[model samples]
Target: MTDENTADSNTSTGTNTAEEENQSELTAVRYADGSLGYPAHTLGSDGNPPVDTIDLREYTAEIITWTKATATPPGVREPNTLAIVEFEIDDESVRAIGQVTTTEITIGDRVEPVYVSELRDPTAGIREPDSQAWDGYRFKPIE
Candidate 1:
């Protein structure tokens, strides 16, 4: 693997190969100050940072810790309690909450990233349970 730090710089026009441009977009935000943001999926509802989407790998995780929700946040009534999970992504760890009914998630369980639709139940009265559905990343244990 070519070390990106030591990779040859285009001393001429200052551009790399065409294949590099076609590769998956890295999950980083370059600041005007020449600093790089964290490489992570912008899948939070907090509206803090990383307002753009980032590339994420699927079916490549193992659960490290999990917490089963005991109570709904405030307004929701009949919504199911999701399991908040922290899992490994390469050497880095990522956290995402996932829906579960019959199966229980445990540490070290092989998990994978899954895109779930936003919970759209009018009866429950919770319009946005977590955040925008497509922006959220959920995980499921590999069967």
Candidate 2:
């Protein structure tokens, strides 16, 4: 009999191929301790199209890679979520604390990781965005 696991292993080795295709492909992903979350990258964002992009793969060395195999489409990058992260993929460290609000249906440059998809991930972080503060009321002169 033949070793069942041996022959099949060659094709599985192609995992590297997928990475090659994604090389410099330009995607937006959550940056945590420098490691990236799988497949949760955006192909493009407003004003900035897929034509010019940010290579998240380049930032992988900052931390451990954490994410599912599947991919997500382009949408708003949420600042609120990005703020709570204990670490970031960016070269510099961010000590963020603020609040932000918006319609659930809408998205923008600010993208956030869904709790279900990201909370457990080691590299992921929570958001603590700031709320919009109201201005004091103005007084009117009596006629």
Candidate 3:
């Protein structure tokens, strides 16, 4: 992945050009009250509008919990491992849940977001492939 630190040149626009070029970067919402949230919220926890956005790919998060799902939604992988991770940004904690790249993770393990073109086989689902997005980020244990 490209170095996120070098993407600072585009901060004036509130958009990271480096992140835009890197699909692995996870987009997160930044609230006006100085809080961050994943899955990008339309409104803040305090009911205020978002102030800006941040790329979670620039940060490394710690695993809080994990589990394996044997019964998954259609098109998703069976026995897929998922984890809830916490990222510390500006002294605040932002938690998100996503699939793990592998099952070799544990609590307290550090992870980084990696882009997956298709989290599942879209065609394998009941709905039309173009009806919904199939790409997403996955957590990979950091070396």
> TM-scores across all candidates?
0.43, 0.18, 0.77
- The alpha-carbon root-mean-square deviation between model 1 and the true structure, to one decimal in Å, is 14.5
The 0-to-1 C-alpha lDDT of every candidate, in the order given, reads: 0.42, 0.25, 0.77
- Pick the lDDT winner: 3
Candidate 1: worst-modelled 10 consecutive residues by lDDT: 1-10
RMSD of each: 14.5, 22.1, 7.5
The list of candidate 3 runs beyond 4 A from truth reads: 1-25
Instruction: Summarize candidate 3's per-residue lDDT along 1-143 as a digit string, tens digits.
Output: 22122211222266645444655457788898898878887898899988988888788999999998999998887778889999998889899998887767779999887766677877886789887557667787777
Between candidates 2 and 3, name the one with more favorable TM-score: 3
Clashing pairs in 1: none
| Candidate 3: clashing pairs of residues | none
Q: How much is 28 displaced in model 3, in angstroms?
A: 1.7
